[model samples]
Target: MTGWRRRETKREEQIIRVLQEPPEAIDLRGARRWRWADEHWRVWLRRSATGVELFTRWQESDEYRYMLGDDAYQMQLIEILTRATPRDCAAAGFGCTRRMDRACSEPSICSRDPLPAAGVDPHREGPVPGGCDSFYGGDDVRVRFSAGNRHQAVRWSMSLWIDGVRVGAGLRLASSGWWLDDRFFVVPAEGPDEHPAQEYTMGDLVSVIHSVLIHDAALSVTRVLVPGPEEMWTEPWVVRDGDELRVYPDQETSRGPDRTIVLTD
Candidate 1:
């Protein structure tokens, strides 16, 4: 028999509450869109029924969003964006796609190499030495970029940005960031594992989420979704389909039920 049950900390208790029921989503239709940009990122803001919606365009590439609620949050976010500046390294990643592909072939070397200018090759002088860039978010959102570790296998750390401010407590595994709507972004992450670490059959891993992280920009809070006691889902993927979010394993052979959550209030 297990000795004594460990008491959940305030953070753990909050995670439990959020897993039981997610925070409310505010409607964003008919909202006004505002724009802000610096050298590296472009930001778009739209004020909704009860909060604001923020979208980021990364260095002429991908776009993602964050939804923030409450009236005061908007003013604060704007002030931060207005004062934001670009990092010297921010431009290093702008056109590194081809370089990234080449670097990944030997990631340790790529991650630790120095960044070359847009049209230059970083691999010319053996493996470029030492780190790379930084990223910043706009209007109720925050962004971070890591200059991969040379000594260890590369994995990303979870970082959260709120009201254009960076908060250090979010977790993300294997770099999963899926937007649930104009406001929420979901991240599949590492959770509490009571079982001993050992190899488990794929069959034993489906239907469980150590935890699922959902950022409610409207509430400026990061919410977590955990599984019930008996089932643990492995390598889950969250996808948005019209008014609903579905969480399921990415593999085809896994025998697990897909968890669905409705986005409409």
Candidate 2:
């Protein structure tokens, strides 16, 4: 997986640029000449009626079954981690490209990188193991993340990167919501502090998860929807407070009008 990031040669650039344009079958012959025989790509680019579908193509591979085990919820963490509500960007000094959209398209204009902490290197430092955990803490990190399931309640954990790969203390307190747990580090999200009588749904919570992933939500309020919308809510935010790891209210978080989320409001 380490080499996967470095293989972006001129040919890949050409293919990507072309794929970004129209829907058509691309010839692989030209793309091959740019790479060594050992350069392998696990991703597939398929032309669709709308555009292209880029994903790790493993349907026909021997590892297809194993790869299939990847959780859809877990895979979405990356996008969610970098997402923000349109209001968040607006309050942070950005105007709308489209009116009434909940999400913001220009994260760059904002000065804050809300995910847990900032300056997370997208590049991993070491050679990745063939059978590695789903969530990786980069640079022998003080922070940790894990592969977790929404089904399991009361089971999650977290960690903080202190200094130069020295991981700080961690905390674990499971009981609901989506979490990023990789055995060593677990960060659980809190559900909306809605009254039990009011019928808050998983979809509502997932929308909140978008905020949570972006590091733009209440840290103490970390939670996740459990076991397919049964509404078995849990709170799993149990992390030690430190410079490397600090939990607080998202300054950009703005619920509708007259918000009274006791856990937050």
The candidate maximizing TM-score is: 1
Candidate 1 lDDT over residue span 1-265, tens digit each: 1333334365688878889985444433212122222212211112111112222223221322233434344444344332322221222222122333221122244333244341132112223333222232322232322222111111123344434444336443434344444355565656546533322333322223455666655455565776545445555566656677666655443554467878654
Candidate 1, lDDT over the whole model: 0.38
Give the C-alpha miss distance for residue 31 in model 1, angstroms.
Answer: 43
TM-score of each: 0.37, 0.20
RMSD of each: 20.2, 18.3
| Candidate 2 positional error at 15, Å | 39
The local lDDT score (0 to 100) that residue 115 gets in candidate 1 is: 47
Per-residue accuracy of model 2 over 1-265 as CA lDDT, tens digit each? 5577557575689878998986544456434332311112111112121111112121122244355554543333223222322122233222222322222233233222233322122211111211111121122111122232111111113322211121212322122222222121333433444534224335323323211221212232232222223233232232222223322333222321111122222
State the lDDT at 64 in candidate 2: 41
The CA lDDT at 45 in model 2 is 14
